[model samples]
Target: MKNRLMITAITLLTAMLLLAGCGGQESSNVASDESGNKTEKDSGKPKVAVVLKGLDQEYFKLAEKGAKQAFKDLGVDGTFLAATTQTETEKLINILEDLINEDPDALVVMPSTEAAIPVLERYREKDIPVILIDTDLKWDGKTTYIGTDNYTAGQEAGKFLAEKLSKGDEIAILEGVLGTDVNEQRVKGVEDVMKEKGIKITASQAADFDRVKAVTVMENILTANPNIKGIFTANDEMAIGALKAVKARNLNIPIIGIDGTSDVLESISKGEVTASVAQEPYDMAYKGVENALKVLKGETVEKSIDSSIEVITKENAGEKLEEVKSILDK
Candidate 1:
């Protein structure tokens, strides 16, 4: 009877200990999103995700500001992410894959290259809205494409440069990524315009849209072709770099570029860079999110939304700079 009593006491202690251990654990607040990702418990807000090519440049920073502002004004649960650099195509693809598993209600992306199209299609299959900004894709899956008409921007910049030089005068072109669609369109636009104006393209080189690389590339071009009359760069960073090389050689010639970044606008104000075909990156990003919200709401959005472009010269560079700063400050 003593042995039986001892066994009963031990069984009772085990039951009590199990109860206490269960009580000591904390409650889980984590809940699954409608698409099965971890999310806040029953928040009425829609989940929106933005992924850019990279945020290393000032131009991309302006885009980030626009997205963040829309996030605040629209009252959605927003997540912004980016690749480390513009060239990190694989990293960007990986980010897209991870975001897909999250299954955001909508997606905004500035594609690094055409490689991102396959990953974006999965969003389409899942019925999640995809909004493309800056660099666009040919995929039918994209809900809408919001950015500048790059070819038009390039044509205008080429026209501005051609006006400063006489026919038969040779000029050089500073390209971005060699075979990328954006670079190709911009370069082709410039080339066709140059052809019409009877201007010869003496040197066409790719600096990958980097300022330092442009400096080195421009230096070599100047050494090889001393009498080149004017220059056109695919983007402002390359324009700024080329300017340094030209100044080093005491060569004064017209140079035009796209992307009316503050640095380029400042140079234009100083009468250094001749002009810039300014794209509205801010508007592109803002409208991207705005349209994404509409898609989520079952409202129709246009397939193509042109954010528009402008030509900034010394006469209006200061005003444009203030406009850009105001948007950034907000």
Candidate 2:
């Protein structure tokens, strides 16, 4: 009886082992997701992770909308993530490293700066495609960059600002974070155009892309140069902040910024802000994921994708605001 029981136990062990061995890669079976969309999660779907700069601002939130929409539309198991703030480089790297271990098939990153290059290289080494959005890194392994031409946007802004001011009229520039390629290019574009138009640049100072910081910096600039005629901020937040500073002193001036956030658009509509060079943050992130999926599927993608830019002024600011609100609603 004991011998019979041992034989039965041995047979059951063999059966269990064979059953375990039969399980191979996950199936790509179609399944109904919670949203009633057909998904491949039941089996295995491509896992793509998107690590954006931060979600602290509306611009990044718009980018987030794009990524999420792209993930659903493309049928990929997308992981959308971001650091709490753009300045949290270390935290962003940590998140990237953890994502690397999970071995996502593709990565879409809107890096804060070049600080993310080494970590991105790891994805390259693993043969995982890395797509950059918003901020472009110098690494050759990047599948592509999808964002606005910051310099061109700046040039447009410069031209716009110059149109209202006479030659030799002094204007101050509120630069974004120093050492950033975005800030540098945008600032350079404005400087070049302003120089071409014979407009005097009184001060170009970094506000670290912080609205409150912009207020402080603008206060200092206004104090130092009380006759500052106009202001051009690298982004809308800084523009709004500078506006606050200008308003506090009852000074009315043309203040143009790059990002066309709804707040900026509203301000423009109300004739509070002069204008904003609108960038498609949502489209940048949307294309970033779409192209990453293409790279995963052994398809060729362009090394660069310009989402497009627009100058939102008082005339169209109200219309643009409605359009923007409709997109975020989706």
Candidate 3:
């Protein structure tokens, strides 16, 4: 009878140990799923998906550099995607949909248009965190926004141009794509400041933020108002185009543009572009990824983060160029 009781106790102990081992394994599997699949805390590094507007532009290239740097620093897996053309909203939306299917731990996006907002909303519905970089959309579902305050940057550009031009001086405006928040706010800021300064806007036309389109638009404006004294372009790409148009006319005009791209800085150094409202594209992208990681880790993060902006002119273009070079080089 004693031997039989001892054997029964040993059998019960073995059964309990087996059950506990199974329970532990199940709990680990649940934990891994709760965190995004393939997360650093579970399997390997967390995967982040970044969808930019277009990769062909200089500004986006700088942003890409920043995103890559963040991946290296944070030890996260990153996949970057972009539309071939800046204005291809359909393509961008499709890319976003495919990324959603992949179900990455986080997403960073620069929406090309308001049309992309609904697609982003779907991500929110699925409980995936998103961070907006560079351009912004009308939606509030994003985890956070990481970019310069474009309206404020536009106001700065206006103030810079206002200082150089006299009241009632005829100036032309080379606008970006229609219906983009960045373009609209920047234009409004410029209009408000120009109105206050009594500066007359000779012409304002949408160039879709394309350099080639800007050249044609600038030529048309010059033809209509050959006496225009100044020009304000929504971005540096358009500014460069306008500069080319002005050069072709053998005219000297103070042209201010946003985005302190290397090409624009070179133009500033050469006294071609008067100044630019320099945006921290690299910082915006880097912080976008960093903030996404924080979201994944359940850490608190600010809803909005301004990467900061600056005014780059001939006086300080060289210094700004070096700073930009350092970011791109890294």
Candidate 4:
């Protein structure tokens, strides 16, 4: 009878232990579900890092704004970093490397130089998709480029200048930094059209995309050559600087520049500048983010996205001006 009683006690103990084990397992599963970190998507949204060439320039600031808007709309985590200046190639590359180390889901970059090609290639090897915005590098690793058709935009500016100038009129070119693809392509486009039209370019100089430097260069060009009748500045800031220089000379020189920045558009409306090739930077930003999300979803995006450009002159300045305002309004 004692053996029977002991057997019953042991069986009850075994059953209790098994039930406790099952309860513990159920609690563990509930805790795991509550903690919520099993999958990548379950943890949080993907991350993207946006790197710009510089933050000081108005152009770069606008690009950054676009990027921020894109991130917000896409509902992704994005961080923006900038090199202090366009000439800071090493710093820019370092920034890129640091961001890459974070293992961001994607990167959108505005490269300062072609040397960044290999660095970007590394990102591709790691299976991280990259998008180029505003400026481009010579790498196939990038999934898409979202910005102006810079070459065509330059050609349009050239054509506008050509139409405004008569035969053999002396025109001066204020180029951005040398060797960068954006500046090179823009300068080439202008020179190409100028070559086709048989126009004379009396002076050309690199202003390093600096407004003050552009002003100094324009002043020198004006002082050295009294015959300059027109100016082609690679960017709106430079064009405005040239306008200041021209106005200081008490002379009228037709100026055509790129970027329909609010100030540039205002200059166009005020007849201070002849025209500016307007780049839809905001739309570029919005689309870049939209496309990034699409890319994440395994949707195909175009290898290149030309945000489109337009000539904003006094004739259509009001409409162009309003278009930019509407973008801001949004």
Compared with the true structure, all predictions reach lDDT values of 0.88, 0.88, 0.88, 0.83
Q: To one decimal, what is the Cα RMSD in angstroms of model 2 from the true structure?
A: 5.9
TM-score quality measure for candidate 3: 0.86
lDDT value, candidate 4, whole model: 0.83
Model 3 scores a C-alpha lDDT of 0.88
Q: TM-score for every candidate vs. truth?
A: 0.88, 0.87, 0.86, 0.84
Give the per-residue lDDT digits (tens) of candidate 4, residues 193-284: 99888788989999988888988999999999899888999999899899999999799889999988777888888889999998876676
- Candidate 4 residue spans exceeding 4 A from truth: 1-43, 322-330
lDDT of each residue in 48-80, candidate 2, tens digit only:
788887898899989988888887788778777
Between the candidate structures 3 and 4, which one is better when assessed by lDDT?
Answer: 3
| Residue-pair clashes per candidate | 0, 1, 0, 0
**Better structure of 1 and 4 per TM-score:** 1
> How far off is residue 75 in model 2, in Å?
0.9
Model 3, 80-101: lDDT tens digits are 7789877998999999997787
* Pairs in clash, predicted candidate 1: none
